[model samples]
Target: MRRLGPSDYRDMPWKNGGGVTRELLKLPHPSEPARFLARLSIASVAASGPFSVFPGIERTLLVLEGAGMALTLGGAPEVVLDRRSPPFVFPGEAETSCRLLEGPVRDFNLMVDRALVEASLEVVHLAPGGTRTVPGTGSVLLHGVEGRASLSGTPLAGEETLWLEAPGPLVLRSDEGARVIVIHLTRRESSSSGT
Candidate 1:
């Protein structure tokens, strides 16, 4: 398992050059650094505008701070999102744009190449002195969001993340309550055919 803190994050301009993002992790294609299998980042949206397009990527986004925003994907109806809302999934290639509800907002994002891997994102709440077992069969990323948490007895502070390459069931415990975002990624069977 690998632990990543704020210092490990890389700051980069958005693909569209409209804003900035702190890339927490990026798994590049084995032979092509320009092509990535999966990526995790946090974006700081300072103004309302169009989102960068990613032709073959699936995107999942969750508000981490501020009042949140509303997203208009392609020609679909606008979808409102806030801190309490569940993570929203959408096509990265869609014609997407957003409007801030109150002001600038910070959000967590997960993007996966649909043809290479399948992915899921969810938030787990732990009460004080609570413990939960998280499956770690594939690539599981546990990001601490609120309070303090421990993964298999290893302490994880808020905003920190632990990447479990592959393991059995893992215990996650919180002594004073906590909230965590878990991302599960698995390679597609067809992707193993050397495609």
Candidate 2:
């Protein structure tokens, strides 16, 4: 397990130039935004605008702060998203954009190369003894977007993220008033290996 600080994350522009993204981590350190095996970042939706699309890259977004925003994906109906919203996009979608419903807001982003990988992310409210064991292959990232938590017995504060290499399982839990958003990233199993 490794801890990553928000102050250490890298920032870059979107391919379409709509907005900027603060890249947290990628398969290869310092990998370009347009090309990465798996990428994590945070975007500040300071203005109302359209979301830039990246074909073949599956995306999952969550509102980090502020009220929320309305999202339109391809021809699908617009959906209102806030700090409590979950991952909503899959691969092969046409267009995705957002318009601020109540001023500016912050959002978390996760994109992966679908052909070579798959991922799962969620925000769980943990009480005492509330623990989650995330399983993965290759690697996985656990970001504490909210309260304080621990991974494999190590403490993590808000905005701190952890990268776990290939292993059996990962543990997450909080003590006292800590609750965290757990993100689990993993490579997809090959069909040839047999389920």
Assess each prediction's global lDDT (C-alpha) against the native.
0.92, 0.74
Please give the lDDT score at residue 135 for candidate 2: 68
- Scored by lDDT, the top model is 1
The 10-residue segment of model 1 with minimum total lDDT is 27-36
lDDT of 2: 0.74
Expressed as tens digits, the lDDT of each residue in 70-175 for candidate 2 is: 9887788989988767776655356777889888788888887776666777776777667777665566677777677887778878888887777567777877
Predicted candidate 1: what Cα RMSD to the true structure? Answer: 1.2
Ten-residue stretch with the least lDDT total in model 2 = 186-195
Task: State the lDDT of candidate 1 residue by residue for 77-116, as single tens digits.
Answer: 9999999999999999999999999999999999999988
TM match of model 2 to true structure: 0.84
Pairs with backbone N, CA or C atoms under 3 Å apart (clashes), candidate 2: 51-97
Per-model TM against the reference = 0.96, 0.84
Number of clashes in every candidate structure?
Answer: 0, 1
